[model samples]
Target: MDHIIEAIASALNISVKQIKNTLGLLEEGNTVPFIARYRKEVTGGLDEEQIRVIQENYAYQVNLEKRKEDVLRLIEQQGKLTDEIKADVMKAEKLSQVEDIYRPYQQKRKTRATDAIAKGLKPLAEWILTLPRTADIEAEAKKYINDKVETMEDALQGAKDIIAEMASDDAQVRSRIRNSMEKYGHLVTKAKKKHTDEKKVYKMYYEYSERVSSLANHRIMAIDRGEKEKVLNVSIDFDEEYIINWTINKFTKKRTSPVNYLIDEAVKDGLKRLAFPSVEREIRNELSEKAHEASIEVFSMNLERLLLQPPMKNKMVLGFDPAFRTGCKLAVIDHTGKMIDVSVIYPHQPNAKVKESQRIMLDLLKKYPIDIIAIGNGTASRESEAFVAKLIKDYNLNVSYTIVSEAGASVYSASKLAREEFPDLHVEQRSAISIARRIQDPLSELIKIDPQSIGVGQYQHDLPQARLKERLDFVVSKAVNRVGVNVNMASAELLKNISGLNASCAKNIVAYREEHGEIHNRKELKKVPKIGAKAFEQAAGFLRIEDGDEMLDRTSIHPESYDLAKKILKELDIKEEEMGSASAADKVKEASVKKLCETLEADSYTVKDILDSIAAPLRDYRDQYAQPMLRSDVLELSDLHIGQQLEGVVRNVVDFGAFVDIGLHEDGLVHISKMSKQRVSHPSELVAVGDIVKVWVYNIDEEKQKVQLSFLQP
Candidate 1:
């Protein structure tokens, strides 16, 4: 455990004391945000993401420690414990290594060894391992040669098979074989060319293969997909003599035994029949797990970024679910996002006139004066974008429209949340409304939808579900806490994600609000049942009050931290009651921030922490993504040539290249060479997930909708 803790501390470059303090705060019911923001004295001001990594790695280390103890116990029970073996067991860092060391001792069903022993071939096998010049192999084999062992040939054959099995099962052999394969195995994929006539799904992958050791995460995923489709037959194979020679050379250099020749033959046989198969399975499984981890990690990060996108500030929004067959489902929401009305417009219906749908939208536009239009990017979305784009231009409507990434709009529409929100409305209406609502408040709206359906992941569904859920949930929870919520207005769903606020507590808050009215002051919160000292300490500072009757009510200062805020203002000789207004606000807050840190006996980062906690700006939410760049003109699809110039946002950065969104349906890939003026090991060195810059469109495949953009100027 100490070793693991030291490893984590080394990786993060933080003190063990800080790690311990952070863990204690986490265990005592404070959230990453709470600790980072208010309890910075304890955590040394580690952000939520850093804290999550710490928490996850800390848990892994604890589990590894338990596994180490268990392995040690198992080896002792098997009478194989030695100082060297104990040292190896203690040094096993990963689960796989620990399991590998314990593998030989693990109980298994009867194999060739058991069958050979059953046939009385154990004595002959022992003789081979202790070969003496006086003993003849054939003479020793004759005694055990019978029906059970068959002929003298069967006796020797059985002995050979048992020896091979024993050699393969040896921990040292398995470890050597596993390591060699990881370094050298090539994943050879061949077509069941004859099975081509069967017309299975993997036809595309049948023609290609590569080294398993070097396969990239995305490529391995694609190959796995191809295999699943039955279009490819893939096999991972490697040269066994290479691995056998390496292992035998490393292990046998210590001894010059009388049975060395027999042992060599036995090892050769073991490499072919036993070691190769076991190692192949182990390597493939390891590669798959590595690929899964990479995919899940990227998915988890993207999900968090997408979920935390800034919400459209208090405004009534009209969401349009565009579809050709059913026309468009329109949902008009009030300032609080309550559905005011819903209707349908036959904008694309064959029998209907364009003018009729045009008039329908204009009427709603006038009625609502909607602050934003959320159009689902599915089905007739492009047409709808053109429709709305032209509508705003021709009529010069003040309402602006955003093309919402409505990946799970339909799924959420079909969910119970949709039913509860619009029970009387049709499924299409619910779906369209969800699309708009999601654009307005992505975190609140998307939480009702499964993250997988939101579609930013590489192989979300294929990932280990438990791992995937854990990762996605952590991201979501972190994002929710970072955004901070209006306890008075936030939905129960959103509130439930707050630190220390469970489903029951969230429901109680909502019910309490309903029974009374808008919570006028932070003090009013103390009256809520079960929201006692601990829960309040955990949740109060995170829940904001838009215009609470009390001035501190609107700030993120916890009720417990309030006295220090007053003391700071008093030190400056300012009255606390008058400090809430515009004239004294900044001075009082700055003083308060410093005073809070001083009170807590923390650092300058802690003072800045208190500032962000008290009043985070709207930019805090949207800053996670590439900032919006509204173009004055549109690039017509027909105007595009192979080489075009445009401005783009860095949607995603990776080791290979940067994906740039240039106001198009699909983002363009700018290979690493074209990324910057200098060399870099990763795309993130120059470009982040969201950075807007000029790009040159190098290629266009309209059929595939792949736009190639380069950051390099012409």
Candidate 2:
């Protein structure tokens, strides 16, 4: 345990006390979120993410200790546990180092070493690693030469092969090799356009490749897209000499032998055959996993912000899923997000009469009292937006329309839930309805579907299946937990994602609530087995039980906290009856914080986190970004005769260009050609997702809805 703590402290650059405290909190049934948020005094104020890192390192340290113990046991059983070996074992900090030290003593099944030992050449390989410059080294090999040493070319070659295998497989050598490869190897990828399909999605990646060391998250994803479609080949590379230095340094530093010449050649063969490919793959995979995690984190953060973005609220919205072949699917969603009505019109159908469809939309707009018409900005989307624009202007309707992201709406339409929700509706209609509902309540509706289907992650499908499932499940759980669930309406799938509420626990919570009445107070949750105080602690803040027995009960305020809150209410001369909705609850919360601060007698740093966590205490403890918007407006796609001033949103940033949404349903291209006024090699230098900027509409293609935009104007 002490060794594990030391290693964790070394790896993470934190004190042993911090690691021990974090582990203590973890052991005491506190979650990372709880320990990080509620136990600030216990953990010395480590944030959740920092605590998570400590937790990960602690686990790694534990595994390292177990591996060390296992190595000692295995060597002891082999009867090689000499006093010296026992002493060496005591000093091993990590599993890899222990494995390296135990390399020669480990049991073997027929390898080059076993073969060499059988051929009476075991000492020769040892001599080579020792680097002894004896003049009769060739003579020593001559004595062991034989038919089994098949092809100098015979004995020398056999000894060299055995030594290379031993050196390459030496855990120390491999670790060093891996480290060197990661530190020096360049991730290389290239276009394989010869086998490409123009019909495939992500055609932009047909000619892309970049080094892993310098690759950003978006670039890695782009290369992954290319490789996924068989349009690119990727690999990691580094200078051969660099790999040699790492292995030789470990070998000479550890061994007493003078085997420089032999070890050097052996390293070449070892790396060329084993270490290079394996280490390179590890480096690439680690990089990919890191990038994937970052991408998912960003997506999760963005989705959380988008979900919490004020809903258009009780206002009916018109959603348009536009297309050329099947026309458009339009749905009117009332404030409650029930599909009040749906219609199919042919405004974009090339062979149809456009004027007739225009009248249909105008009539619906006036009838529904719509607040916003969310147009799916996909193929034929701009034309449909144009059609809707003319309708709003012609009818003199007061409704506003905003383009909606239909990134994975099509995938949702084909899903079983979509099929069940709108059994009789056409696929296009299902998609349109989804488009509308996403705008209505993104978190509520999105929780019902798969995250990968939302198109925010990188290589989500290509990820290792088990790893992907674990990570995606984590993301879903965090999202569900962050946005609080309605006990009555949540699907089992959505319910299962609540923190500490697995499939079975979620089912029981629902079952218990259903079998009885609604959960009057969170204390009733104890009736469900395995949902003791611990589970409730993690799950309560994120679950909403509307109109519960207590005024604070319906909100995020934990029941354990009700007494303190009641005292505050009495002190403020306020009744529980008066503190119910958003405003009243907010004031009561502020008063409670003041009282709690006085009670705890701690610094704001200590008391603030706890107070903020006393159920929605009026402030969202979780992070939230500001809503994205354009700085300026582009009135028309064609108004840019050459250089027209426009405002745009940085929708998607890439190495090539920043795709900016400038009022058009289609996001225009700000090709790397015009990302900034300064010399820009990469678009990310001056912009990123959600940057609102003034850009010049450089080129307009009315036929394609592809307007080229630039940061600099002529």
Candidate 3:
């Protein structure tokens, strides 16, 4: 435990006390958001991201410890566990290192080495390994010759096999080889003759070789996928002769030994036959694991940015799910995201009833006072967008339309949860509603579907599903809790992501709300089944109640802090009902956090958060980017020209670059090289998902429908 704590502290560059305190809070059932937001003093002001890192590292360290114990026990059972070996195992930092240390003592399958040992040639192998200068190797081998060995040559071969196994199993030897390979190896890949990719997705990698130390993570995943699909064969190449010599030096004490040639042969055999295959796998797996982690981090960041996109609040949105064979699905949602109407219009193919469809769309727009049109970016989207843009311009309609990613809307529409939510509506109607709600409040609507299906990240399906889900879920939970939910307005799905509330507790809250009407105060939350004191303690701060019994209930002030808040307000001569108003906010902002802490006998961190909360009651963390890019115009691939500047929303950020949506159904790629005149390591340095940026068209592949964009000015 102490070792784990110290290692975590060093890795995170945080103090041991902070790590210990944060771990303690986590063990005591406090959620990451709860610990970060409320236990600021306890964790020495660690933020949610830091807390999450600490938690993840803590779990890894615990697993490493368990593995260490297992390795020790297994090695002890073999009766080869010396104090030195035990110390080495104990000092091993990673699980891989532990396994490397344990490999020699581990049980093995039937092999030439085991067979040689069984033939009573173990003593000969040991004597040869000593590399005696004047040893008569053939005479020693002759003594071991028997029915199983057959002759002196056979005995020598058996001894060499045993020596090869011994060299391969040495933990130090394997570690050195792995490190050398990782530092100097080149990842070589070649396409198969019969398995050509017509789309040329993997064309660049068809004949490629890059240093293992220098390959980008995205390239690794790309190469991995190509290898997996059998389009390419990949291998790591390095200096095998150098590695063989290094292994030989471990056993050869005398350079002029008569048996040195035979020992060298055995070492060479070990390098080629046993060590390289196993070590290459270890190096590649390590590289792939690192790549997976880096990719997951990228995915998690993108998902976080995507989820936290500001809601288009107080707008009557018309969700238009475009299609060709079937009529386009349309659903009208009010300011609060309630579905008020549902209809379909056949504007695109088969029907071609443009006049009739135009009339229906215009009527719906006028009927609902629709503020925005959220067109789904899917099949027939461009056509639908063109139709909407022309409709707005031709008639000079007040509403504007933006292309909303409809990646998971259809999936959500067909889900069992959707069935339960909208039992009366068809799947298309549900989809329309989902698109509308997503624009209104992305986090709320997005939490309903599987996050992996949201399509915000690269290679999400290739990632370990459990780890990906866990990380994406954490992103959702943090986003939900960061922007406090209105208890009366939030769905069970959104509520389930609240800090201490699980699916059952969230359902109970909603069920209780349904039976008893709008929850009037935080106190009423305790009445919900399965929501006990601890749950309320962890959750109350993040659940808002507008026009509730107490004014602070609508703010992020937790229930337990009500007394301190009341005392502070009383001391400041501010009325409870006027807590969040402009005058009260000004007064609270003017008050000294340190002075208040001293007067109220509270932690300084808590006092600061309370003061900030009082200044901006029910403050939305998403207000930083409160508006998404709404377009009254649309573009086509043919309309694009080199150096034509356009404003776009960054859709997805990958290692190489970001994909920006410029009102076209297909987004353009802004490669890292063209992002700026200066060199950039990754696109994330300049853009994140949902960032609105100005990009110029650099080039176009009209036939392939690919647009290369640049963030640099013309």
Candidate 4:
């Protein structure tokens, strides 16, 4: 445990005390969000990300230690364990390193070396290593002749095989070669001879070669996908001769030895036949793992940003899911996201009921007072947008429209949760509702769908599913807890994401609410099934009741600190009803945190948190982000010209650039090179998914309906 603590502290550059305390809390079954929010003093004020890193590092260290112990036990059972081997095992930081150390002693299948040993040629193989200066190696090999060895040549070949296998098993040799390959190797990919790529999706990779160390993670994922699809063949290209010669020199003791040629042959054979393939696999796996981690991090960050996009509060939105054959599903939702009306409009080809569609839309708009139309960016989206723009212009209606990414709307519509929410509605109708609701409250609606289906990631399907799911789940939980769920209005999906709550518990809470009535206070949560004392302790701070019995329940102040809160209120001469009022804020501003801590016998973190919560009870963290960009006008591909400046919301950020929805059918691309005059390591550093930025048209591919945008003026 001490070793794990020290290792995590050293790796993360955190204090040993912080790591130890955080680990203790985690071991006590405290969720990362709970500890980060409520136990700030115990963790030295570490944020959610930092606490999660400590948890991940601690788990990794524990797993590595267990592996080391297992490896040591296995080696000891074989009576091959030495002080040096034990030391090496103990010092190994990664599982791969430990495996490499244990590879030589691990039981093997029928191999050339094992066959030679079974045939009683082990002594000859050992003798050859001495590199006898004047000894005749062929004569020495004859001494080991047996039923398994027919001739002197056979004996010598067996001995050479054993020596080669031994050389391949040498951990030091494998490590050196692996390191050299990683530093100097190139990943070379080529088009498969028989494969046809009509789309040219992987054209750039047909004859591509890049240094392994310098390759971008997106490129690696792309190449991997291409190879998986059989469009490309990939291999690692390294200086094999240099490695072979280095291995030979490391093993050769005397240049003048008569058996030096045999040792040289064995070393070459061993490296080419055994070591190269094994090391190449290790290198590729390592590179793939790194690429997956980088991609997952990018995906997780993008997902978090998308989830936290500011809601279009208090707006009556019309969801427009556009399609040709199915017409377009339109759902009008009220300010609170309840579906008020549902209709279909065919404003495009085939039916092309332009007049009738406009009448239906006008009637709904007039009836519901729709403020904005959330157009789904799917088939016929631009056509639908044009229709909406023309209707608004023709009728002079007081409404606007914006394109929304409908990446996962279909998936969410068909989900069991969606069915439960809208059992009588069709899938498309449910999708329309989801679209409108997502625009109104993205965090609430988006949480209902799987994060991967949100389509904010790159090569999400190609990455390890379990790892991706784990990361995305954590990101969702972090975002949900950061925003604080409203106990009364939150769906089971949102409630499940709250700290210390699971699907079953969230469902139970909802059931309890349905069976009885609205939970008026935090104490009422105890009456809900599956919510125990520990669960309540971890979740209470993040669960808010907007108009509950206890005033502190309306704020983020934990119930455990209610007494202290009241004492502080009394000390400051503030009434319980004054929370979130201007007078309460003013008084909190004038109070000294240090003096309050001393007077109240409380920690500074607790006092400051309570005071801040009191000043602005139930603050929506999402309010800090920019609201979704609304547009009354629409643009066509033909309307775009170079150097035209336009404001667009960044739709998706990837490794190469950001896609900006410039009110066109196709989102414009702002490549990394054009993102800034200064170097940008990643697109996220410059812009996120929801940022509305001003960009100019650098170029336009009208044929492709693609617009190239740049941050700088052309």
Candidate 5:
């Protein structure tokens, strides 16, 4: 346990005490969000990400230790465990290292070496290893010739096979070779001779070569996808002769020995046939694992930002899901995300009833207090935007429009939850409602869909699905917890993402709310089925009751800290009802945190948090982010020109750059090189999803409808 804690501490550059305490909290069934938010003092104020890293590292360390024990016990049972072998196994930091050390002792399938050993060639193989200067190799091989080994050549070959397998099984040699490949190998990809890549999606990788150490994570995933799709043939390129010669030098001890040739041949054969393939596989697997991790991280960050986009509060939004033949679907949703009206308009081709569509839209605009239009960036979106722009200009309607990524609207519309929510509505109508709700409350709406379907990162489909899901779930949970949920208003989907609530618990909370009416305070949550002591402890702080019986419940103050909070409020001579008032804020601001900690006998972290919560009981972390871009006009691909300046919202950030929506059907691409004047490792360093950025159109490809943008004006 000490060793695991020390290793995690060293790896994360955190104190051993902090790692130990954090691991203890995690082992006690506490969630990362719970530990980060409620137990800051115990964790030394470690953030959610830090605590998650410690938890992951502790799991890895525990698994590694268990694997080492299993390997040690297995070797001991075989009566082959030695002090040095045990030491090597015990000291291995990675599971792969321990597995490599135990490879020779593992029960393998039928192989040339095992076959040779069964034919009395083990003695000959061992004798050959001595490198005797004056030995008759044929005569020695003749002794091993029997029914199984018919000829002297057969015996010699068997001996060589045994020696080859032995050399290949050397842990140090395998490790050295793996390290060398990782450091010096090049990943080479070529277009397959026969493939159906008419779009040339992998054109850049058709004849690509990159150093394994320097390849970007995005490119790795792209190449992997291309290879899987049979568009590219990928392999590692390395100096094979150098590696073979190195292995030969390691095994060869005498220059004048008669059996040196045999040893050389055997070492080469071992590397080429056994060790090289296995090491290549390991290197590729390691690279893929790292690439998946990086891609998942990018996906998670983008998803978090997209989920945390500030709500377009108090605005009645019209969700416009545009299509050509099927007509554009429209649904008017009130500020509370309740669908109040639904309509359809054929604004584009085949059924180009422009006048009728205009009449329908204008009537809806007049009937409802629709302040803005949330147009889905799907088929016929550009035409729909143009129509809306014309209506606002021609009739002079007091309305603006913005493009909402309808990436997952269809999926959500077809979901079981969506079906239950709007069983009478068609799929498109439900999609329209989802689109409007996404603008009003992105966190709540997005949690209903799979994170991978949100479409904010590169190559999400190619990523490891399970790992990607885990990471995305964590991101959603963190975002949901950061922005506290109103239990009375939250859906089961949103509640499920709260700190300690699972799907079943969240459903029960909603059921309880439905049956017994709105929960008036934090204490009422315990009455809900499945929300026991631990669940309440983990979840209560993040579940807000804005107009609850208890004012502290409206804030993020945990139930356990209410007494202290009340005492502090009394000390400041502020009433509990004045928690979010100007007078309360002023008083809390005037109170010294150091004096309060001393007086109340509490930790400074909790005191500061309580004071801040008092200043604004219903503080939203999402309010700090820029709202979604609302535009009164639309830009066309044909209207774009070089050097034109525009304001755009960053829709997605990737390894290469950020895609900014500049009021066009196709989002503009701001390449990494054009992100800034200074050197940037990744585009995320300069911009993130949801950021409203000013960019210049450096180049425009009208043929492909691609706009190349730059941060600096040309």
Candidate 6:
């Protein structure tokens, strides 16, 4: 256990005490976001990312230890467990190393080496290695050429097979070969014979070769997907002769002896027949796992940014779900995201009822005091944008519209959760409401759907489903917890992500709220089923009661700290009613953290957190992030000219670059090279999913409806 803690500390570059404290907290059912936000002193101020890394690495180390125990016990049961082999297994840092040390002792099916041993030629195989330089190999072979072994050739071949297996099973030899392959290997891919490049999607990879070390994570995932689809054949190749010579040099002791040539032949045979294939597979798997982790990290970060998009609070929104055949679905949601009205307008092709659609839209605008229009960026969005633009101009409506990504709207609209939430509404109507609600509160609405369906990732479908889901779930948890949920208005889906809350507990909370009235205080939460003391301890800080009697209940201060918070507030002469007023801010700033800690009998960290919360009770962390671009006008692809500068919101960020929505039907691509004049390793370094960036048109392909943009402006 101590060694595992030490290993985690080394991997994360943190103190051993910090890791131990964090592990203790984690073992006690504390979540990563909980540990990060609430246990600052215990973890030495480690943030959520650092805590998650420690947690993940500790799990891996624990699994490695379990595997080591299993290997040791298996080898002991086989009666082949020497002290040296046991020490090697015990010292193994990774599962692969432990497996390598246990390879020879593992029980196996019949093979050439096993057949030779069964034929009574084991002594001859061992004797060949002990032979001197002048020893006659043929004389020894003849001695074993009795009953089962018909001839000298058969005896010698059997001995060679045994030698080959021995060389291939050596742990050190396999490790060296695997390391060399990783260092010097080139991964190459080619078009398969049966596949054609009609779409040219895999054309660049048809005859592509790149050093294994230099291949980017995105390219690796792309190649893996193409290979899985059978559009390309992929293989890793390296200097085989070098590997063979290295193997020989490591195992062969006597270079001038006649047996030396036999050992050399066995080494070459082993590499070609067994070791190379096995080692190549190991290296590729290792590289793929690394790529998978990196891709998941990028996806997690992007998802976090998208989930934390600042809400357009206190605004009545009109959600426009664009369509082609069916008319555009429209939903009017009030400031609190309650559906006030719903309608359908056909402003696009096949119907093209522009005047009629305009009349309906203008009437809805007059009926409801709509503050913003959120058009779904799908289907006939451009036509809808044009119609809205003309209506706003002719009617001189005092409102603006922003294009909202509707990637997962259809999926969410048809989901079981959506059905439960809006049982009476159609799928398109629910989608229209979702489009509007996402703009008002992205984290709440987006959490209702699967994170993978949110569509901010690269090759999300190709990723391991369990691992990807786990990672995305963590992202949602962090985002949801960061912005505390209002217990009154939050749906069960949003409440489920709160720390220490699950589907059952969240459902119970909603049920309790429905049976009674809105929960008005932290004490009332205990009455909800499954929310015992421990669960309340973990979740109370993240669940807010907006109009509650206790002001701290509305803020992020945990319930346990209520006494300390009250003491600090009393010491500062600040009233609970005026806790967030400017006068309270002045009192908090004027009070010394050291003096408050002394007065409250608490630590400085706790005092500072209390003071900060008092200054800005119920502060939304999403306010720190960039808000979506609310556009007063729209642009078209045809209206773009070369070098024309425009404002765009980064819709998605990938390894190669970013896709920006410049108020057009199709998003423009800002390639990585055009992201900056200075060298940047990734597009994320320059922009994130919600960043509003400035770019100029560099190239346009009208036939393909692709727009190439450059963030580097003149």
Please list the Cα RMSD from the true structure of every candidate, rounded to 1 decimal place: 3.5, 5.6, 1.7, 1.5, 1.5, 2.1
| Residue pairs with clashing backbones, model 2 | 130-257, 130-258, 130-259, 131-258, 131-259, 132-258, 151-154, 187-212, 556-615, 632-647
lDDT of 2 by residue, 424-518 (tens): 98888888888887766666666666666665444456555565555555556555555567676666666777655777988788788678867
For model 6, the stretches where C-alpha displacement exceeds 4 angstroms are: 76-87, 146-148, 257-261
Better of 4 and 5 by lDDT: 5
Residue range 452-543, candidate 6, lDDT tens digits: 89889888888888999999999899999999899998999999999989999999999999999899898999999999988888899899
In candidate 2, position 618 carries an lDDT of 39
Candidate 2 has a TM-score of 0.78
Ranking by TM-score, best first?
A: 5, 4, 3, 6, 1, 2
TM-scores for all candidates: the values are 0.90, 0.78, 0.97, 0.97, 0.98, 0.95
Clashing pairs in 5: none
How high is the lDDT of residue 572 in model 1? 53
Tens digit of per-residue lDDT, candidate 3, span 1-714: 898899999999999999999999999989999998899999999988999899889899999999999989988887878999989988888889999998888788999999999999999988887767687777888998778889999999998999999899999889888877788889999998889587888999888999999999999889888988889989888888877877888789537788888888888898789999999988888778788888988998998898898998899999999999889999999998888999999998788889999999989988888999998888999899999999999998888888888889989999999999899999999999998888899989998989889888777777888988888888898889999899998999999999989999999998998899999999989889999999999999999998888888888888888899888888888888776789988898689878888888899987877777777886889989737778787788888899999989998999989999997768899999999898898788889999999999999998779899999987
Question: What are the per-residue Cα lDDT tens digits for candidate 4 across 1-714?
Answer: 897888788888889999989888998999999999899999999999999888888888889999999999999999999999999889888899999999999899999989888999888878878777799777787787777899998898888898898889888888888887889989999999999789999999999999999999899889888998999999889999888888888878536688888889899899989998999888888888999998898899999999999888899999999999789999999998888899998889888999999999999987888888999998999888888999888888899887888889999999999998999999999999988888899999999999989898888889899999999999999999998988998989899999989999899989988888889999999988899999999999889998879888888889999999999999888999888889999999999999999988899999999999888886789888888888877798888788999999998888999999998888999999998899999989989888999999999887787899999987
lDDT of 1 at 557: 66
| lDDT, residue 29, candidate 2 | 70
Give the per-residue Cα lDDT of candidate 2 at 536. Answer: 81
The models' CA-based lDDT, in order, is: 0.73, 0.67, 0.89, 0.90, 0.91, 0.88
Q: After superposition, how far is residue 335 of candidate 6 from its true place, in Å?
A: 1.4
Per-residue lDDT tens digits for candidate 5, residues 402-480, read 8888889999999999999999999999999988888999988989999888898787877889989888989999999
> What does candidate 1's lDDT look like per residue over 1-714, in tens digits?
567768998989998877888888888877776777677667777888778888989998899889989989988988989998889888777888888777777786787767887888877877776545455666677888776866777888777766777777777777777766667767877765455336444555666767767787767776676666555677776677777776555434535665556567667787787778777877777778888988787777667767766666577888988888768889999766788878788767564557888898999988876888777767877677777777788888887776667788888888887787678888998887787777567788888777777777666667799888878877777888777788898888888888878888888889999999888877777788778877787888778876777666566666776665555555555554554445454654556555556665645664554344333322255555653343323345566776677877665555467787665656679988877788866565676543577888777778777877777776
Native-to-model Cα distance after best TM-score fit, residue 98 in candidate 4, in Å: 1.5
- 1 or 2, which is superior by TM-score? 1
